[model samples]
Target chain A: MSYDFMSVQQRYIEQIEAALEGAIGSEEETLYGVVQEAMRYSTLGGGKRLRGMLCLELCRLGCGEYERAVPFAAAIEMIHAYSLIHDDLPCMDNDELRRGKPSCHVRFGEANALLAGDALLTRAFEYALRECDYAAMGYERGVRGALTLAQCAGLDGMIGGQAIDLRFENTRQMTPEVLGTLHALKTGALIRAACLMGGIAGGMDEGQLELCEKYAAQIGLAFQIMDDILDVTATSEELGKPVGSDRSSGKTTYVVLYGVEESRKMAQECVQEAKKCLHDLHIEEPFLYDVAEMVISRTH
Target chain B: MSYDFMSVQQRYIEQIEAALEGAIGSEEETLYGVVQEAMRYSTLGGGKRLRGMLCLELCRLGCGEYERAVPFAAAIEMIHAYSLIHDDLPCMDNDELRRGKPSCHVRFGEANALLAGDALLTRAFEYALRECDYAAMGYERGVRGALTLAQCAGLDGMIGGQAIDLRFENTRQMTPEVLGTLHALKTGALIRAACLMGGIAGGMDEGQLELCEKYAAQIGLAFQIMDDILDVTATSEELGKPVGSDRSSGKTTYVVLYGVEESRKMAQECVQEAKKCLHDLHIEEPFLYDVAEMVISRTH
Candidate 1:
């Protein structure tokens, strides 16, 4: 049987794309125009758009309307976009290429790129907050959902992880625990938040929310490890960015610390854990299950 | 005669300082320790603490409860701190000194500084969300407040202003209108947010909220103009940071575009407008009015 997972993910990506486009519109005032353009530049410059799709899918699975989740899906993607813009800055990663295009700074200049990233990050919350006016969903649930998004995006979550990653760069000894912490905040925080926010938006009870979090945590790490593996194996053409860029930057990765085989095994184990969590939930969504498997198995 | 306004503003600042200390307790682990330390590095570094004090004052004036505004006050300060950290980055403002100490990047390295700034910005929301839950402020209001904060900080507000400022640097002759737009976003947005959020938290009526917004807008610009004037005149020893840094950077200022006398005259007019708004509110407290005047008259 052909695994229809890619098709399902593609559909989800399209939905998120439409939602993002709708959310970013503005009139012709100078300030608003600049903001709208900056937002478009960072977000429209594409990637997998996975954060948004996962959020929408989980919201649907949790019994929330896909429409209700769309704002949040766009918001999370904005956050992801902002992080990429800033990460590519000269003071940071200084990458010239992203998604096969000149980086934001290279295209728009450093000042605009910095401002663009900052704008997108701030706009993420603005989008998430629009959910507050969704009369169909209870206001309390919307507030909780936005709050969850903020927490994940903030210090204790994604930003914190990024700090650790920056601090540990170029160090010869990289501990497993440190690496885990870094990935947890850097990559895992936003993913877990995406899952949790969906559940919260869908009005999941504590138990269902817990299950989603567990699954999300596993897949999030698996996703990062796969990214690490891809850095070593994938070509620039396939990856749409430079391969071996991570190693060249002197940044540590799972493959560097654990070797390729062990790292792959670790990623596989994470997928298995994610699957077990889904199985325990007894939900019959084959799409989410397949997506979990694909998190580790994908080439890029 | 003693200025009761000065005393009252001082009292509010003291209360916010105490509450902020309580809120930022010890870190849980090394990871959290780093996060917490970075937060304190910025938050604890001294400015006038105007934003936090304004938040508490607004809460008290609107809600008649200073205690309830503590988290919001802290959250606003966190946002302010994060912005300063980012603004001082090498690629941004490139300031080596802030508040008489080495900048965050200078002390922590560029990567950690960037992460610290990100964390503080993110944590501001986390702290605010916690308040939404703990204060039992209905979810609708909490979401609205959070959304408002995001809008103020986002592209349409703070980041947008910063973008224009950078774009105009050493390249274009700026008009007063352009300078106003830049200052509104760069400085006015958060100040206005501080006042508005305080009112929101307190559940103020629409009229009162509008008054606070008006007052905040005037004062925010007034504050920036005052800084511009000080940059032209204040010595480094008195200013705590390098004096005339804005001039050195070849950035436009109120004093540069308009003559110093004209900028000073405009600042006074703005202060008068702000006071008029407060007067229309018929508030019992005279100290807030005094604080506004003091803000305009401060030497450093």
Candidate 2:
């Protein structure tokens, strides 16, 4: 009864990569050429494509048209890519490498990288809502999807988490409560949005959408806790960037406060909670349970 | 039969300023406090609110509910403020001042300023589409308005122009065609969006929306040309920043290429063309004509 996770994941990644490449136009010699190149370089370079997979898979679980969700899937990936680009800026985390390649700012120069991030974020919305005609996916779903992405990526969500992180860096102000809030807003929001958007696309009612969000929220925290553990235990080559960045930067993380063993236990508990939500929602898909397990199992 | 230009303008400014202030929440003591302060500091500092006025006025001309368009007006101004903040970043224009006050980075460190800009842009869309329920502004209008703002502010528009400007700065590669494309995308696209968004809110058909876009494009170019002329002729006290910045940065502008006298004449011609579009659309609003005239007539 086990699902073939590897092949399904590979197919999803291919679909996502193709959609992402197609989303950014192929005009490199034009006026906005360099920024476009930077965008393509950073977005198409490489990543786990976790958000896109979650979105597309959830949509399939909801029985929504897989083709209709492709743009949304690509859009979320673009948002995630832009965030990483900005997060690696000199003024931010200042990471020089991402996914074993020079970061966007390092490769494209600072100004172009900044504009590329801006362009990616803006174009994500443009691509997602481009087919907002009355006939295409219906206006309601389009608006809902757009709003979910915007709100999760916005002030009270990712950027807000970033501000908190920057302000509290090198300080002892990050308590467990603060850490929970920070991680929830920073990482959980987008993951929750991906789930909710997929649910919306699949015509899930409000209760079902809420269940998806709850499940996503649990996995999101688990994902971050696992990331912290990986940062501490994984080799620099495996992580593609320097390991222990959080410690070096004096930033607080789950593994910093609660050693690796405790963090891993916490991630397992979160995954278990996430699986419970899926069960409560009557979703018996083995992939759903497998993905929750994968959150804690991912090494990089 | 003439409208009271000063009085009408003052009222519009009041409405816009109030809407903008109301749009940004008052939560300065939270984790996101510093970034929110930076957003308010830069967004509420001071600007002419020209884009807001254009959008609101066009909406009125089309007989849409003034209250509904207020969010869109404030949203556009937020986008403008964010752009100015990023433009003034050290990696970008490196300007120290904006609106007679220290820039966002000077007031709030570099990272917070960057986050503030990102938050503002994301929240602009969130705020505009918050009421996308079927009973609200109608999903079609909401989608159209959101799409218009996103497309105009995105890769092929404002960000694209900024890339070209940055790439060609201090270089002799900025041909006339390049300059035209730059201004049209950087400046014209948003203005055109304002007009078209207003038309959409007012329930104008596609053809009428096209006329509003045409009108806006003409005035957008003229506005930029006039800005170039003022940079040469006006004082720092008048423009709220260094007057000869363009020339000193080795950035080519309309005045640099054609002289102030010729640029003024060109601006006037553009205004005339804009008026012709308005007339063709049968929009007898004198305020629209006066606003177009103000583009060329203002000293700063």
Candidate 3:
């Protein structure tokens, strides 16, 4: 059964926020009180919650109970949040704004921010593996899902992408190939994991999971291109954060290489390919389609 | 077939070092070459592979095949290495020497060191979960072992202990209770996890796992007390690293609270209790018994 796109997305976002509040020890201050505060501030402060929603929606479309995926959903968001925190470190991107507020390192000390990222990454595995405790999704799903999550976060994926991105800054290595490889690991890998994990948790067959991954890759790449486009075209207010950040940082982005209009066209093409994957898989989830659209159309 | 303590220890250490070399992508550098190099440098440059040995030795003693525990043994060492990397960060302990060489953050920059720690931690789970690939270990053990690893590494354990240690620096919060809690999380939990995970991998019953935990805790605490004693009693030449670091850092170490003599006596008492647990549980692992002795008597 298809869902009403906006309502389902909104509902999943709310559930994810509440669950994250509970998962992050928000009710009671942990003994790691300052790090806990830092984690909660970075995580619960506010974002689109797109990763959580993507996971829950895919699990639902895979004919699984969405409640069982909630923990994993929140876990992926924590992983995403940790990456953002580390990316904003003074020695890294050195951005002072995230989601319209001072970044974690800007608010907390750099050390606490670093520890909070590590703590958040550690907690993601804890939460992902806890899926084994729930009856609706048993050990097999939990183990596989958690492993998938770990794989995407490791050197082969997000972290690897980040290293390459850092090494290429203000360098002459800004080819289209390098940029594509960079985003594939930096942003696309985790997004792919979010979808793959949901399908795995839902007990989808191998072919179905592959299809989910294909769709995820397309959308993930589209999402990054759209981000690049918005960096050049959208106002800082419209973006809810600073615009022209990519150019100012001396980093190569899709818009920098292909121009804003071409970058916008490329994003739309990716969204189209992503929709084709859903059609081929015969996925009946309206939320998934709308989610793909949101990536490229967010600025509008 | 009980063997000489030294020989058995030497053999296992060799196997662990070789296995870790394989596990940390020794075949080729990862895409994140610098971080990979930092991880390899910190991990392979060993002081003692104590954690890996505990896991493998206990597994062997549990009547399981030693080979089946190799991956996990390598994984725990990676976890230990990650902790050291983060602990040596300029923002943390600010130590420059590890294993008589420059620490990870000193050798590599702070940002790469932080990412290396994250990558190592991520690889630990990746390796631990690969136990699913072996027909001997099976998914049940692999999944359970990994869950236990995550539990020990998360907020309730190592990270939590680290935060407390950081906060209590140069502060008046040094109670016996606080010191007890700090060390319990800082060092004890992973040691406990090492033994308990060995038990879990060997298919030990729940009661047996609980007994393993008890033995682990006593020894783990005693190990920390001995470390404190060594910081005061040992020399830079003997310790192979700087001594008196704990006091210089304004930490509330066991020796600080109870004096060197009392801390030594307390360490001996804890070691004795640790041996008593093995007697009570009828664990016939002589290496484990010797391991407890080595914790308190390593000044030579």
Docking class of 1: medium
> What's the lDDT for candidate 3?
0.84
Tens digits of per-residue lDDT, candidate 3, B1-300, equal 657999988999998888878777763554568878888999985757777888887787676567777878888899899999988888778888887788898888887888889899999988787554346766677777887888898778888899888888888568999889888998998998898888877777788888889888998899899888888888897876799888887888888888988888998899889888888778776888999999888982
For each candidate, what's the DockQ? 0.60, 0.88, 0.67
lDDT of 1 by residue, A39-124 (tens): 67668737787777778777888774666787888889988988988888877788888888888888877767777777777777
lDDT of 3 at B77: 90
Q: Estimate each model's TM-score.
A: 0.94, 0.97, 0.96
Clashing pairs in 1: A154-B122, B5-B287
- Better candidate number, 1 or 2, judged by DockQ: 2
Q: Which stretches of model 3 miss by more than 4 angstroms?
A: A1-3, A27-30, A133-138, B27-30, B132-134
Name the regions of candidate 1 deviating beyond 4 angstroms: A1-7, A26-36, B1-3, B22-29, B133-137
User: Candidate 1 i-RMS (Å)?
Assistant: 2.2
- What is the TM-score, restricted to chain A, for candidate 1? 0.94
Q: How much RMSD separates candidate 1 from the native structure?
A: 2.6
Lowest summed lDDT over 10 consecutive residues: which window, candidate 3 chain B? Answer: B130-139
Q: How large is the interface RMSD of candidate 2?
A: 0.8
TM-score of chain B of 1: 0.93
Off by over 4 Å in 2: A132-137, B132-137
